[model samples]
Target chain A: MHADYLWTAAPLIVSAPMAKVAMPKLAAAVSKAGGLGFIAAGYHSDHLEDLLQEAEDLLQEGTAETPIKVEEGTPKFLPVGVGFITWSASLEKALPSFSRYCPAAVWLFAPPQGFRDLIPWATRIREATACRTKIWVQVGSVSDAVEVVEAIDPDVIVVQGLDAGGHSLARGASIISLVPEIKDKLQELRPFPQKQIDVFAAGGISDSRGVAAAVALGAHGCVLGTRFLASPESLVAHGYQKALLDASDGGTSTVRTKIYDKVRDIHGWPEGYDGRGLINRTFIDHLNGLSEVKNREMYREELKRGDEGYGVNGRLTTYAGTGVGLIREVIPAGDIVKSLREGARALLYGPHNVSKL
Target chain B: MHADYLWTAAPLIVSAPMAKVAMPKLAAAVSKAGGLGFIAAGYHSDHLEDLLQEAEDLLQEGTAETPIKVEEGTPKFLPVGVGFITWSASLEKALPSFSRYCPAAVWLFAPPQGFRDLIPWATRIREATACRTKIWVQVGSVSDAVEVVEAIDPDVIVVQGLDAGGHSLARGASIISLVPEIKDKLQELRPFPQKQIDVFAAGGISDSRGVAAAVALGAHGCVLGTRFLASPESLVAHGYQKALLDASDGGTSTVRTKIYDKVRDIHGWPEGYDGRGLINRTFIDHLNGLSEVKNREMYREELKRGDEGYGVNGRLTTYAGTGVGLIREVIPAGDIVKSLREGARALLYGPHNVSKL
Candidate 1:
């Protein structure tokens, strides 16, 4: 039941669970390249059985890019790590399918409404799966994190900063400020040797320096979402990837708001949660919360006109962190793992000149 | 014309040119510790001569806490660097007083208005004072940077990120993103051997990690504003400093808006500029921009009832960066410089574990 993959994952890197972006190929590639890779299990509660079945198939017949290699010295790529939005109907629908498939780790994002019952749900997952999956809960604030840890006592807690791409929970605090703040808060707790809790910093981190910075800031590791969005193995449409490269830095194009989600009709996300993406004409027009008759209809037309991330109206949602400016070209998932490892290693142990990486 | 301070200021730390907060004692302490410390020459346009005279006395007599030391193998702590808010009536009012003291560097903050003629003004300073001061121009955007560098050819260009405490020029970008963004923008220029411009990252950077992070982000150095404001030598009132400490992490207390400046009745600042500080009852009550008469009087009455950085109605305006939370305790100014230098050096060149610092 003890998942050795948690400590065995080399480079201490983890691919973020991005909905509609992280696919099996990307997850497999990251795992093969010696980092923990996750399959974003949000947004598709109905298709949980099919997705798990596909994961089983994908595990058997490895892709052309990279196969899951759990060799000696190499990290033991646990069964696919799946993340679910806590309040989503995904849990109820997928409850039947989860017992059949063993996940290396299961990450749960607690919503504000049902957050109190999160521990019960986590208990269910652990009980249902015979405690095979290591539980990781993501928290946005100092207070929420302490509460969750006390209740569920999960294996890992991700301290999500405000600069995170979608649904940041950090109130107004940044990663540089939030990580230490959370660590300081966590330090006050009495020793819990029975449960070892590792903390990960998530947000605008895009490169090797970010990895080093986060580690220095007391995070056991870092979870990067935006960087993985640009990986080739991601499920994003080709056109969307092109748009990401076009709006690479994202300073001029990106704005954080709930408008994109409103236009897309992606409901059920909790309040206080918002998305950061390339600002489009539709977003600009409908930023004040879309009205059903006038603006929503106009937005539907704009959405239908585009197959790529962009239409004539502008860009579709491409959720990204503020560090989007650091991304240059879309590379393979394995390459992302490799480059991040090399870069972090260089900054942490190599010469002082990190820019050369 | 050759200022060794620019190249030889070891550790590459700068006490920010914070008006009212930075005084002779603070500047001298930073300089004594082998970093560039600047006396803010904004707001008090008419008193430049007296300030320069004070700087002369402060340089000679020094403070009991820390004294200016020009030791061998260390920076000479050049003629105290003085910064002026470019549009302030200070220039016209203090032109006669400028030539009386030869400052090591005259840093000019480019005002949004009349920014075009900043070069001519620099030329006039060079002509009148016979080029005794190395001119430094602070720029906000990439386009503004290109224009300024081409026109004035300043010795340094500080990429002011949006997280800077005071008025910042960065267009919706944080320092982690903007420093590299500006560096990339500057790469397009052909060799301007006559004047090579060094870039400094300024904004939310709160600690030694920020120093290492900035250097890794392609900055020649990093400028700290909020961190320095907490120094024992800062001119902030005891009550205001208490408020700053209470609002320390800055997340709960601070909001970036022009309303604070408007309330303070501080004028001569350009349009598009705003202040970031601890939000008080005044900001919450009159967030829609203070209407005249009644509210202004209430705010004035509220401002008077404070000693340290706090008042009965919360805080007046504690200008702060997003990293205000990083400050744990107020120590001497030289200690900040020493700690930042040691911490950054450890992270950059020493072992990977930096949290021990």
Candidate 2:
């Protein structure tokens, strides 16, 4: 079946499941606006039930209309998806939640044993949910996409480039090249007239222009992390939001490094994966040969400052992609999705459309 | 004037002036196929007259139907453009050729003193060509585009991202983010109803999908470097072509480094600029702690082997972007341009167009 059947939107827009940041409100708001929203289950399953329940309650309250397309006779499941840092999250711990609330999809990323490690998680989740939930795997390099597809035959593949925020392969091309390459390779492997696997472009995408561009790059949809960070529904601190707003040339202002994870003592990320964030004192100090212990101490001090600790001078981590510069102000999550969809539609199909070649 | 007036194509396509590789034949072939083409002037003015003369002869012979549109009352000038490695190519040495041929455009890149260094070169070229030659400046960052625009008010700005092959800023985002960011910033500076500066995307663009994506990302056009390398008209060696064809997953097989320049003894590139090329024993050996002298010695030995020296195991450089994996065959440059144009047209305007959002 065409993977687009899983979503109701024409150009599927997805809010990335940024750990601790993407929560029930953000997830539900996106789904309410005709896009897919995901909750970051993170490395622990302790809070997944509560998050899903909150999303369910929000959906039931009918605060906003949802556009999620549920197949006839399908079992009850949350419209929102759940993501995990597969390297640190245990499948056993997450299986209970998967059995309870079969999210529309399960996004697996950064497995320690490479894509093969995701096979078990995908299989168990399928079994637990009776295949109700779709399997989505994120990959940076084409090899990873190939490997993952061969192993799990995932329903969706999110091709994330090096310009992405949080963690990704340290070495990978951008979506301009990566998306089409992966799409072509997958098409060759599966050929046409087979069960088509949907491809979503992620990283460095902040607005409608990016969504339209990703669609032109042969992606069926787009996953946005940094853009959603500017939404009120996201569980981001005020200071972090301000930093993202104040940031202007993110290509230079942001960098990919393990310093944020190191200072936070989050060491379980597999090799070749590093987080992209604003270049601040923590990173500068690390570059200047400051000891890890001293950096950590400063970071702890900044953390106590609450909203004040996440600017250019602040030591707190402000995870963002290179597209952070495009984010101007905080808006409602539903508005972000609606605006992107309308803007992309105009740009792609308007009278002045330049994409007509 | 809108930059589209400078060429005759819809969804304007341009062949990148890859030094030593992009010759008159390739440039003329692209122009013949209804797109703009550029001849790389390299770092010297010695053979410019001969190159321009040969391109003129080719156009006259009409081996291919020329589609380059010439404006009424425009001074006699070659339809193709010329590019310079601004840091090393002296304006005085190149002015004679510029005055004689009065090329359609002059593309400037990698000036040592930054974009300001291009001021004199642009001024003199305009003076020599009586302001007929359009100016195109290549930049890798948003700041650089802003700086160059403020300095020269170029007719076109080529936004080269980090995924580009050949020399470019070592630190920059991919075109997925860079193109629209530059486009927005330039619009903010120039506003609407002002002389609109056309923005073209360069980097990791191999096929029609990339062109469509660039247009969707707000770029007025696209510049293809690696894709053209697979064309028969490119000055690439047989071994280099073979390696490019054999290469898959270019994001992992290629790397950006100054080691190629270091080994070749071509050190004129300014700070923050580096070249991306296929990784081989030369780079591997250097990574393994091989001394510069030892690496150079091995490079010299490999150079003697001619075409045999350019492969995964060989030490010779094969400059290509991250889209190398998509280039499978060596076709005629005209065919490449036509195919890309038609394919992009189909993808962007076909009945199955998914970019409609």
Candidate 3:
């Protein structure tokens, strides 16, 4: 019974969208591999509609072998989800996708501060769509978690700790402490007015023990980023993959800043909210002359390189979480998922007990 | 050539020394299995001689196989090495086995600020025995590394990075940067070198990619502490092994302090040099109040409860490196070594060819 429900196969992994890395084909391959695939709705051109169509088309083609069967009485199908940078979703044209494609879930990042107003809009979407639309708000601190639980009442609360890659909502707490605290707090305050929210832990959840730890810490599952960043299906350049593999505990250090966002012309990120990323040669030079190169033009040269696809050379930071330290290889995302599941199971069940079971 | 040099059907691995947890028979079994077996040096006692004799006796009675030979031309001997806390090595009385056993290498840690004089004496003993004595210094920064290289000029330089388990030299620098810098510095200053120094990088080197990455960055090999700390042969409590297996990325937090040293009453660690270890409940409650109860008498009370002995009390502070984040299993060290070697070779020989070898 467990075998049927529990995924345990060669391709049990999913590839998540990263900035500029997650493209249509990557999502399609993950879905094709029998795992939930997601399209990152954060950084992209104005042709988001075309991009969504492309991803939907790929997901359809990828899942052609085993079409998702919606039982006659069931609501809708489940195969793919769309994750939006919560801060980015509020932009002028971000709502176009809501009017167009019926995505599985709208995974939100760094839940906005003004949650009192966004509640009705979120409810409206859930009520209107047959799709299991969830408000996947990313958070770091226990307080932020508490705020989201009370205000947004998200369908799924992604406890993205400091270990997670990309932008984070963690005020300062690390995932290690934040996970168990949130889990315990949720458990203690359960069966009350608060909805039964399924918690997922992200940030540096690269493998199975990580998955198991999250489960132990009160998370249903895990969300991996850097681990998937190196997948063959990921649109990340070969150089980026090599850099990820090459990094170790001290190989890369991340600093949260709005320096790149301003240069890349990406706006609307909330104050006190910044992304963590690698510091390359350009960053070093800029840091050396921070006072001298205070002007936007000086930073423009660095920013242009990233926009043009220079890969690691330009100031385009390899926005990664602290978990970047854990990534050593870029294997197929499917293999990673298999390892995570098996490893988690093995960790939960003693090796002796596991074999006996 | 590599295949022949490597053993296919042996179960040799390192033994953990969890006070009373490690038995002589386990050490014998590891040596009998065809791997390097280490007996942890006394942290609070001077019974190492008795332990060594017991291990030798056990090997003789445990098997019918021929006594293990480390390398050809060496006297019929056991492949046993002694591991010491660098801070403790300063107490000459604690290192009585130095003259009696003639250990292959004396792994040094947090050497006194000006302990360069001690290296010659330590080196002379190994030179007299012609045991190919290595001075494995634990370091975190490039400056610390340079000091170690300039001072000891030992046979092998073991660079214990942030990822390794146990007490590491606390320099804010990461292993990734340190390893490359050490390699480059070594290359840059070649003629002064007595021999081409071999640098082995440690910490978070849990798998092949880690080993391959270290070797690529100019490390001859790698060292693993946490991965070995949980093996069946280790003296660690079963619960500790479970904790290690259940850990994930950022699963355990590492802090450098004299809290454990003060509590264990194990002296000799110089000021400014602290050990990195697990931060548990005891640390959280009493870490700030250490000054009030920093007495040997109170430590005795904690030791009487014997929390450190059983590794149950969070205050006992388990010396594990940040690599605890990656260790998900307690398999034999030999199996780990084999996997690392094979996996590294696979990647090195794999089509991508990111590795320098």
Candidate 4:
């Protein structure tokens, strides 16, 4: 089953399924460029069918220009994947979509009931797709990875770090430490001769350097979220895109907080999970003891400003990772994938590399 | 001056100058194993001579077994370096040590007055060593890196991230993002045809995978602190070593706080700086609203426990990075260096590697 989705690229690059931002175009573009991409199903399955259909249309159109090569004996499915916020997403509604258009994979994240909650979702997805769609579980801690692997035996484990954008574990190690430790624990729990479980690193990765670093850290590939926010294919507002570009020193310019969700009235994120975004008036005002009612009212007013609503003083949320500083310009999603692949390969194997002695 | 300290090792591994923990034996062992090492001068320059002399004796004794190869056209100096907390270190007291030992490098960190405070320190050290001792400044943010480069034009910049142990910025990005952004900014600020400034990554790096990842992230090498704690040569107590070994899920088990310093009666760490260590009763009590006076008294009591004072329930400060979970056992510092080097090289260029397709 894993062999069916084995990417031909030397270092697999994945574009994260950012809620509402990663749409059909971005997902198809990444897949066209030999990288796996995911369309976010978000917290609901209401629009999943439309999103999948749109992605299928784009991929079909691109097939004439640059088709993703499928290996022999591999079952037919959409090359792109879909992502779900497992806690709120309706498994019943999603199973029909899976049966209708089988995505290559389904990424599960932040289950309120823990890894066990994912077992039923995984079983249903596999049953719906006749085992065509692989299960990918996102874990921020070694314990979570161990439980996920034990409970559902996910085909791929995405090891996310504290430096990631959007939603993530409120407390987590950076990939520099987390990936190897998780790898070691998994090896101990499920020794060799078992089914292979590919590990993909996500968080704080923006360019080829990060991809190469993830590979060196024992990850089979990397999943980038903040980097794709700069892609024209991404379904982000101009204000949000501008905010991402204007941001620097992401470690200082951005912060992880539940305030954004609270202002937007987005609840049920599960304990120990929060979102990282560019610091703005909303957060500053919240920190300064602004009443919740007033802050929410101000946030709604800022939304009315549209493109002008996202900046240092803007109240609109601009979700990004610590790697936001590294993103300088907007590029095509396909181009981003291609450049990352080439750059990572060069750093890893090139003779005239600065990393070499 | 920079060329004088050019190491022959690929992906140069470095043992951090963890105050008290990184001693003469540990520094010399790492230097003997083809990696640069640094002895901590701590907040004061007192006892500098003893540490340097001990390191000199150890290196001299080990020269028969393995000598650090020096290339032609480079002036000779002690292969080991010295680190200082610039805010509290007395330059008047350190000059004589530099002149006498002629250490290869001086790592400057935590200057209260800002990057300018390091200029005089760098100038005097170069003059004392006749330009043999290169200056290495540690920066946690891109803005700090820019300021340091403009202020002193350091020979090397140690880019530290939030995941680092010991003292670091209260807020900072992970090396996954910070390193590449700093590299890009440095390139822009100091374009081609300028003296080269090597960048070494310090934070959350424990093994060869981390070393390789740092290299991939555009770093010349890595500085490991927590990984060295398990080394027998390290000046750590038995219980502290046991605590490090027992701790898993470092991202959750460890935290960055100034409470440790406060309890130890240590002060004058620059603003926006704090130390990371294993979480214990001291922190829990402090978080639970224990008065500072009472917390201090309890901390002193825990210290009397000696080798039994460093665990989840113990109050002794066990300074360690998020990589603490990755360190499993005590290995000789030299063996750690060799293993890290060999492992990184294999991962970077090996044919049958998991990172490569």
Query: Model 2, stretches more than 4 Å misplaced?
Result: A1-7, A67-75, A192-194, A355-357, B1-7, B67-75, B355-357
| Backbone clash numbers for all candidates listed | 11, 0, 15, 0
Q: Residue A160 error for model 4, in Å? A: 0.5
Q: What's the TM-score of each model vs. the native?
A: 0.87, 0.96, 0.53, 0.96
Residue B143 lDDT, candidate 1, scale 0-100: 60
For candidate 1, the TM-score is 0.87
Task: Order the candidate numbers by DockQ, best to worst.
Answer: 4, 2, 1, 3
lDDT by residue for model 2 (B75-191), tens = 457888889988888788888887777788889988888899999988988888888788999998889988998898898899998888888888779988888888889878977
For candidate 2, write residues A1-357 as lDDT tens digits.
Answer: 224334447687899989999998999889878888999998776788788878888866554355454332334588889999888877888888777777889999888977888889988999998987899999998899899989999999999988898888888789989999999899888875356688999999998999888888888888999999998899999999999999878778899899999899888788888889999999999999999999998999889999998989999999999998888889998899988887888878877776444
Chain A: TM-score in each model:
0.87, 0.95, 0.79, 0.96
Q: By lDDT, is 1 or 3 better?
A: 1
Query: Which residue window of length 10 is worst by lDDT in model 3 chain B?
Result: B1-10
lDDT of 4 at A120: 96
**Residue A106 lDDT in candidate 1:** 80
Tens digits of per-residue lDDT, candidate 1, A239-298, equal 666666666444445667777677677787776677777766667667565564565567
Candidate 2 chain B, run of 10 with poorest lDDT:
B66-75
Ranking of models by TM-score = 2, 4, 1, 3
Chain B TM, per prediction? 0.88, 0.95, 0.75, 0.96
Worst 10 residues of 4 chain A by lDDT: A67-76
Between prediction 3 and prediction 4, the one with superior TM-score is 4
Q: Candidate 3, DockQ to 2 decimals?
A: 0.05
Candidate 3 docking classification = incorrect
